[model samples]
Every structure is written in structure tokens, then in C-alpha cells.
Target: MEDPSLYFPLPTIKTLLQTFYSSFLFCFLRVFPLCLALLFETLVLVHKWSFLGHLLFVSAVVLYTTLVYHFSRPAPVYLVDFACYKPPSHLQVPLHSFMEHSSRFGCFEKESVEFMGRVIKLSGQGERTSLPPALHYIPPRTGHLDSVEEAHMILFSVMEDLLAKTRVNPSEIDVLVVNCSGFCPSPSLSSMVMHRFKLRDNVKTFSLGGMGCGAGVIAVDVAQTLLKLCSGAQAVVLSTEIMSTGWYSGKERKKLMLNCLFRMGGSAALLQSGPQAARVAKYQLRHMVRTHMGASDRGYFSAMREEDSEGITGVSLERDLMQVAGEILRMNIGALGSRVLPLSEKFWYSFSLFHKRFLDPKTEIYVPNFKLVIHHFCIPPSGKALLRELGKGLRLKKVDLEPALMTLHRFGNQSSSSLWYELAYMEAKGRVKRGDRVWQLGTGSGPKCNSAIWECISPVNPLAKVGSDPAGPWFDCIDEYPIAMDDF
Candidate 1:
């Protein structure tokens, strides 16, 4: 079927225009009386009182109409329900080794090294020697049906779990959006999901691949769009990285980083505009900003590296990955500010900019402090340096970053799931209260960056906490944070 997002009226664009025009009209009318009074004075001085009265009547009518329209229009309310997210039981490979190895690449000072050693001592697990026999059995570099079968095994397990928790039937989902950065083949991931789940023929489905980490928010954006067109239509979103296909066989340090950092992870989410879901976690997806920086081979080469002479493909991040990431994050923030950022923040940022550019010629405006507006934060599993750079740039505190660090220590970088894990951590710790906001930032190939802002609703569900369900036993102890590679 045709992609649902292709046809829906984009509310983001519409809202942007609406806000711009409203602000423009307000300013235009506000200045009109002053301009008109000047004109009237000039006319009276020139002995043209009749013309002044005519202009005054016209301006008054226009100002009145603008005020009435502005006051009458109400703000839009988007209600997003969180369906249960369950990863396949089979794909659970704990991430101590991955976390240890990935963290090493970025500025491994004595403390971080000591921290890694502590994690190793705490987990008491050896380095990941090999994949399970089942995974290893798949012949190298050939995309086959077995890959799909394995993908299905991973997909269905999560789907079934979600269906059970939500009490939603497999056949009832009206829109299916699946985003898998790897292992995409003919018939697409969405079609495969639909076929495997036996979704109705009428269900609309879209498969988004090759979009890397930012795809999760891209999926959320697509779901938000689909929710608007069909009343009662529920959208199911699946985000996963197919490690089975992208496994790096080369011993290159860059290639090995992927092997070390990325693990098998997938998340299933259900979004619906229907009132039933409105009573749930109510994620009013206010804004999404997507910025793509790398179009040329040079720019693309900056973010993505594939280390095979035999044409095998996998992401090999360069040493300066975080530097590229910070640039993209800044670009995305600039685009998003016009839409999602509060006027208070805009005023502060703009004031700083004016002060730096015009008044203080020598000083550059510091990036506006995002810590105050940020309710919770999630950064990807690039490394400690990346996290530290982001914190320093954004002026985030230890408490602001601790939940994310804790999640990475426990879960490794589950790619797209990393943000969800961080969110889960906050919920577990009871840091996310009613009316709190969350900023989810993502980075990926195409040298891209994307962000989504979620405002908390009235209720924070306890059941959504990680390690609280039947899967709790799989997680290691939560008391002392996992400290990998500390030489005590």
C-alpha cells in the first residue's frame, strides 16, 4: 500500500506558517496606529484632514479583525499513547563488553578507565568471545531468507508482548511503520511485519530503512502524521538495528567499534489519536527537527566509514565523530527553536546573540543554556567524551546526565532504544514527574541529527520502568552503577 505519510497534511508545516503569520500580523497592526498617528499629524499639518480620517477608519478595521482572529484560534492538542515496548527474549545479550570497548575510544582518562575496570569486576563477565551458534551459523555476507526469519523471530516476540500488555489484537493496527537501519531487503520491513502478524489487507504500512539512529523520531513523526488522517486508526512503530547483516568482520579499530558498541535491540510502540489512548501516557509530540549535513562523499565520509575492501558494509565511526555530532546538534537546535522552544528561551538566546554581535564585539554568544528548559536528557552511546562535550556545551549538570549514563552502563547503546532506556531510567527513579519535559536527541549516518520533545502528562506509569517487569532478572544490580575497566 502507499505510504500514509505521503498523503497526510503535514501539521508541522501548517503550524509553522500559522505562527509566523500570526506574529507578523500582530507586529504589523501594533505598529500601524503609531504610523497612522504620524500620518495623521503630517496630514493635519499639511491641511489634509479628510484623507487622515479615511486612513484611520481603514487601519482601525484591520486591527480589530486581526485581534478577533488571534484570540479565537485555539492551540492544537496532540495526544500520544505509549504502547508497551518489549524486545525479543532471544536477542538479550547483555552489553558490558560493548560498553567497555566503545567508551575506550573517546578520551579514556584515568577515572573512566578505573570506572570500566569496576564494571568488569562487578559484572564478572568475560569479553564477548563469539556470537551464539545460531547467529554464527548464518553464512557471512549473504542476505538470505534466514535473515528475514531471524528478524521475524526478533520482531514477533516484541509484537506479541506489546499486544498482550495493550490488549490490542495483531489484526487491529491500522498503520504499521517499521524502521530498521540494517537488514532491509525486498518487500520491506513493514510488509514483513504485516505479513508475519497477519495484519488486515486494509492496513497501511511503510518501511523506512537506511536512516540509522534518527529513524526512531522519524517513525514517531510518521506516526503522528498518520494519526491525524484516520480517526480510530492506531499506528504501530518498530525501531531496530539489524546486527545480523552489519556485523564487521575486519579487525580495523574503526570497524571493531561497531562490534563493541552496537548490540541487537528493537522496540515496538503503539500510537493512536483515539480517545482510549488519550487516557494513557499522552505524548503530545509537539515538534520534530531533522537536519542532514553530509551530502557529498567528503561530508558523508566524515560520519560513516565502511572498512571492507570486499564491499561488505558497516558503520565505522571516525575519531572525531562527536565533533561532527555536536555540529549537527547545533544545526538541528537552530531549526527546532522557531517551533518548539519557549519564548523565554528564545528571548534569552536572542538577547545573548545581540549582546555578542553588536555590543560586545570581541565576545561570541555562548550557546544558550538549555539546562533550565531541559526536563530530562538522552544522548547516544558515542562515548564518554561525546557525552561530556554535550554536557559542557549545553551546560548540563551531573544529575541531568546521570540517568543516561546509568542506562548506557546497564544496557550499552541499544541504538534507538538508548533514549527509551534513559527515559525508562528516569521513570524508575521517579525523576519524571507530571508536567516535566524530555529532550530526546539522536545522531546517525548521512551525518544527520534529529530531536523530539515530549511533555509529560498527568500520570507517570510505574509499570513502564525498566527491570520492573518479568524481564527484571536479566538486568544486573542497579545499586552501584556499572563501572567498566577500573584498575582498583
Candidate 2:
């Protein structure tokens, strides 16, 4: 007979262990009556008094499996907080300096430089942080080599800090998931983390790349599933964007926007399963919603990497990025709201949207009160316009969107890591509290919209004392944020 476990739906397990679980479940479900009959027969064959002994044996086995077995599941997964990197003060690049660099280097024409300047000013990045020694060195600010090194520097630093803060040994980590949108090189980012941390040889590692900025949430979703499927597993998820490799050094006018938007940032989050970790965990994973609107051809190619006429490689942003982002957000919210919203809210939302769609396409579709379900928002700081657009679409207020705006103004677009930085901002300001629900929205290429929900179980613990880290992006500037950086 074929091993039924090979046909199981989960992709997490190894082939050797495939039959172990599937066979157990299949046999247990199908032969429970036979087992009881056999027990009774064994009791009769041995002695009439053996019935109580067999029952006691079965009870002990059940107790041991539930209480003592390490892989025994039905365990809850937990988010044990996370760490966001705050590069040194020297790495800060103000708008003036960046624009000057663009103009001086001839990376952009005068008109292109002006376009970039406007983009930077409207970008809401007050003093964007960058990985040191790369942009600081010379005119060709970033390169392919710098990308790998930057990943090593930031990923290792953040991972070390995370493991140190949580006191979890690298070997104790059973799995590792890394998400880097523009840079997934040989050996993979996940493998790099495994090697750097000296993790166990058999540690399961997965690296996600080219999934766009929303890849972070996607990685979290992957980690969440892995932890639940494989009992007793602990995962470390690293979210980051290495702008060095993705730097648009070319003279393409349309592609120059990428030069202004991306900044260097990364985050490391420790997630685990089991009762032991749940005790000290900071948050509980509630629901994760992901939507990739690939069918929309315009949206799919809204952001992409391609070679210019000059043979210079860069990522080009479509003119309709904001519109595409809005569409993705609408779809994502439609899906997410249904799962988490209260019954009344869901009913009202469905009725409103349905009526608007079928009865009156021109009528206003009621936007559900996301605030009623989610207390805190962690929208990725992709850019200012996109941020405002997403907020308005969700009926999110200024305060609700403050954390994301503040993160952008201070750190620029950290890509996948922007969500974590926003989360850090909320904590630093003492806005997060136990029982508060946080929803993170990420928009990226493939026009993907990704969101994850977390319920805070512990109080906020800032890495730097209320904006005290000398290297912290918000150290001297957080108070000035949520200010109208909109010059338009």
C-alpha cells in the first residue's frame, strides 16, 4: 500500500517523516474499533482482571503524548516581539545631500534631478537612514557587491540583537525565514543567516525574494504556517530590502524615482510554538491576509526591474503606482475585513459593497470601520502618496496612520522592513498596549497586498529608551513627525 502521508497537503515536512504522521492519523481513524476489540481480546486471553490494566496503559499513553511529547501539537504560535535596526547617525542622508549627489553625479538630467527632488520632498523621508560605508564612499553610491555585504552587516547585526534580547540560542531555532525583495543571491539569505548564527545543520531555512516589499508579511505568513504544521518549531524571520543592489544608477528619467524612494533597513522577529514560548511571548498571531493581483497586467508590472537603453539596470515605477496600490488595498481589505470584522460590520460591509457593485456601480461603497477591529495600524512607509491613499481607502484617521507616516519621514521607504519600523514607532510612543490589535498593510510589486494581524499580549519594550539611541532614526526627530510634510 502507498504511504498516504506523501499525499498530505503540508509542504513543510521532510520526505523521511512523511509516512510517520499520515500513517498514524490514517490508521488511528480507520482502526480505532479494531484496536478496542483487540484490547478486549488480549484482556480475555490474559485474564479477566487485565481490562483495568490495559485501560490504565492507554490513559498513560494519552497523558504522555499530550503533556510530554515535544512534537505534540494543537499548540499556539506566538510572536515574541521583534527588533528593528537603527543605523548610526552618520549614516543619515538628508534630502539636500541626496539631491546634490544625484545632480553632481549626472545620475539624472537637470529635469530628472528636479523630479527626484520633488519626489524626495514629498516622500516624507526627513533624514533617511542607510547602511554605512557604501553610500558614504563615492559617486557610484551602491553596487551589487555592496548589496551582499550590506545584507551580511544588517542581517547579522539584527539577528544577533534579536537572539541576545530573547536569550534564544541559534541552535534552539528550528527554522529560519528571510525576505529580501531585490537581493536573493547565491547560498540564499536564509542560508546566510543559518551560517552566521551557526544554527543547527538540519534547521529548515526558506528565503523569499522578488516577492516585492510585501514579502515580509508573506514571510511571516510562511513562518506562521510552518510553526503550526511542524510541532515545537521556532522560527526567526528577517525582513529587509538591500537598496545597494536595487539602486537605480541609470539615467532613465522614469526609473530615477527608485533612487529617491528606497533606504536601508531591516528587522528580525522571533516566533515560536508551544506552551513554554507562549508564556513569554509579546503577541499572538491572529489572522494574515494576502492578495496578489497578478491578473491586472498594469498592476503586475507597476514596479519592475529592467535594463535601460544605456544598458544600466534599474527598477521602474509605473505612473499609475498609486492607483494600482489603491486597487490592491481594496481587494486586500475586502478579504481581511470579512475574516476579522464583527458579524454586524461584515454584514454591513458586504451589503454596502454588493449593492454598490450590482445595484449602483457609481454609488458609494461603504468602507468598513477597520478601527473597530484593529486598534493599531502599521502601514508600510512605501511613500507619502501611497500611505495617504491606503489610509483614506480604509477610512483610517491621521492618528491611525501616524506611525506609518512617522516611520517614513524618519527612515524613508525601508521596503519590507518598513512595517517593523512602524511597529517600533507605535511602541516607542507608548501607543501599543496589551489586547490591542495591530494590522500591517504592505503593498509591493506583483501589485501584491499583504497584511498580518497581531494581538499584543505584552507591553512595548523599546530598543532605545524613548528615542535615546544615538544611532536611532527617531532619536532627535520623532516629535517633529506626523507633521504635514506635504508641500503640495
Candidate 3:
């Protein structure tokens, strides 16, 4: 079946006419007095009658200038450059190879290994996804090396590519934000980036820790705020997860899901505020909504990393994660709906919610037609089950869910960077169009639902060859995706 987006025509003619009419009206109003003065002189005194033509020419030029000014105003936050970390080929681990290594590590019990096998098969990760170096070795050293490697290895590769691609000088970056859920070093990740780039003395740096998979969006939100506060400033947002320090060596089956789910990946993005940045920026930040349910017990423990029964450390996924996520999504969407949804859609949905709550508790509440607002959705590539649940929850079609699913299959869960890879997949497939609004929803350990909307500014050319970029995660195999996969 063809994608619904394919059948949906671009609003080129309607939007152009609307813009032109508005601009004309505004310019006419402002220049009306000048036109009248010129007319009066031409008719009454017959002197400076040449002023009429000059006035008319000036009016037309000013009108054109006004239209250009309106259209060319800088966005508060604009994406300049973004790059995702792709590990070396030797580090890519297949399912069977990973299983073999886990069995030989002699850390897991027989039952644990079997449980791990089941999770790995159902994980939706491809064979080429990578693991931490300590885990890659035959005898896994359950130590702090994973933390160091994750901090340096992932951040350096992505920042190098992003800065070089965007042609941004380190000194030009006025704001820096970095998020790493598991690893928070002494000087902080943001400080590391500043030190590595040797940024200006007064550069503002912040590191977000323990925010879970949704930390990337939080970083973006922070950048957006700072950009608005300080005009023409550039910001860099980096997100990653260190699975090496998070390795679960214990025999606890429940805590081992991270082993099967997480992979070696990271992403770096550049955002700036100014007409100069907007001229070349790919996407404009539109909206950001965050809902934190950490006060509740279930939410607090949803993805908590604590000592297991045997005093071994690991992150445990709460059994009721989906249920908690559903509640959080409901609240988050309601707040976001009022902001972005059309008035009619919001009124109807609000009526339904009122009826369901007041009239009939058991009555089925209507899900708002989010398709009317969002063109593309970049959801977290957590796992197959969560992906399917979100698709149904948001009422997204198969084509709409393709990016998330394919990202999950090819990259597994790259933690906060998962959504970036998903968005890149859509771009690589040429699905995202100019003026299209994309919604990115990332659920994190805070049991938080972080939502962000980005509007595409410039036309995306998927067929355009990437000349200088390194062999990243999506290279050589983007065309093979969108294949059929089991819903389970």
C-alpha cells in the first residue's frame, strides 16, 4: 500500500497565496498615507508630480522588502548539524556471537542465559549493532573502563563530524549541553566537550544526568531556552549511553534486559539562533512538552539502576512500565494538544474526554487525530513491544511507524540517540518534506515522557550523496529496510 503522505498533496498553492495576500495587505496599510500624499500633490499643485512615480516605486520596493523580511526572520532555535556515532566494524556483534560471549563469560546461570536468548531474539536488533569494548572481550571485565570509553569514544567522534560539517568554530558555541544517563564524570560531560573544543572562556555548559532515554529532548529544550535568552548564540547537544558500566553480571534475569536492548551509539547536534543560522539550518524547533511522573513509586522505579538481590548492580525495567507510560502519555498529549492541534480537533477531543470522565467512566475516550498535526514521529527504539504499543496509542499507520521499527531492527536502542537515528532513517528514505512537522517522543527513566516538535525549514535531499561524513550507522544498508517484521 502507498503511504498516506504520498496521496496527501503539499499545500504549496494555498500557503503561497495566503502569504502573498497577508504581505500585500500589511504593506498597503503602511504605505497608504504616502500614496495619498503623492496623489494630492500631483492633483492640486501639479508640482513634484514626479513624486507620484517615486512614491509608487518606493511603496512597491518597501512592500517587497517587508515580505522578504517577514519570511526571512530567524527562528529561535535551529538545527545546524547533527551526527550519530557508529562504532568500528570489528565491534559489531551479532546475536549469536553475543550469546556465545555471554555464555563463555561464566557470569550467568543456565536459566539466565536462556532468558537472555529469548530477549535477544525479540529485541529487533540487527547483527551489525555494537557492544561496549569490555563486553566485546572474551573475558568481560566488569569494571569502570566502559565508563571512560563511553565518555571519550562516543563524544569525540560525533563532535568532530558535526563541527566540521557545519563549519562552526568552537569559539562560536556560546551554549553547550550534554546528557549521559548512566555516566556522570567529575568535571561533567558538558565541560569535557568545552575542554575538547577549547571553547570561549564564558561559554555556558550544562550536563544532564539520570534523565534516561528522554535526556536528548531535554537537552534540546534547554538549548532552545538559552538560544531565546541570548540571540545569535550557537548550542551543541550530545546524547549517549554507556552500556559498559551498566553491564549486568549477576544471574538476576529481570535486570538483564539492558544487555539485550542497549547498543554502542551516540549522537551530537548543533543548534543556533540567528538569520544566518536559519538560512542554512535543516529544522526549526517548534514546541517541547515534558511530563515527569517520578513522584509516583511505579514511575520512580520504572527504569531504576540499583543493586540486585546478590548485590550486583544493574538497571531494572519495572513490570508495569507500559501502564505507567500510558498514563504519562495521556497527560502529556492533553497539554500538547491544546498547543498544536487545530481548534476544532481540540474541542471535539475535549468533549470526548469530558464525556468519558463525567458521563461514563467505562466509556471509550476518543483519541485525538494527531495525524492532522504531525507528519512524522520519531519515537524511541526501545523494543518491539513498546514500539507497537506507541504506534497504536498514537494511531499511527504502518508507514508512519516505519522509521522507528527499522531503526530498532538495525540499531537496537541507542538510548537517547535512538530518536536521532530514527529521524535520520526518515530523511534517508525521503519521507520528510519541507514544512512538515515531526514529533519526537522519548520515554526515559524518570518515567518521563519528553515530546518535541520540529518543523523542516529547508528541502531535504535524500538522494544527495554524503561526501565527508564517516561511515556512520546508516551507511551501505539504508535501502534494505521497511521489510516486513512480526508485531510481537
Question: What TM-score quantifies how close candidate 2 is to the native fold?
Answer: 0.84
Q: What's the best-to-worst order under lDDT?
A: 3, 2, 1
> Model 2, residue 362: what's the lDDT?
87
Backbone clashes in each candidate structure, one number apiece?
12, 1, 0
Evaluate all candidate structures by whole-model CA lDDT and list the values in order: 0.63, 0.77, 0.80
Write one digit per residue (lDDT tens) for candidate 2, span 1-488: 96533333233443224335456674464356457656765776678665667776667557545532333344578898677777776788887877777677756678887888888877777765564457655576576678778888889988877876778778778778999988889989898888777887677799898888898899898888888765456889999888777767677767887778788788999998755666789888888889988888898788888999989888888888878887888888889987988898888877887989889888887778888879998887777777777777788878888888777777778888888888877776777899999998887899899889999987766444322243233555666656774441
Q: What ordering of candidates by TM-score runs from best to worst?
A: 2, 3, 1
Model 1: what TM-score?
Answer: 0.71
Q: Report the lDDT tens digits of candidate 1 across residue range 1-488.
A: 97655345234443454455468675686567667766766676677567757677667667766865754343322434332234434434444533454344443344544444554334322332223223433233325665676567656666665666566777667788888876678888888888777887778898887777788878877877767544445778887776667665443445545555555556777777633455664465556788897764544776464546657565776766666776788888888776766788888788888998889977766566565666888777555556766788777876777765665555556576567666656665557787777888888778888888877776765454222343221233444544443421
How many steric clashes does model 2 contain?
A: 1
Candidate 1 residue 185 Cα shift, in angstroms, is 2.2
lDDT of 3 by residue, 177-286 (tens): 99989888777878877778887777788999898898999999988887764446788999998877878899776689888888888998899875566788899888
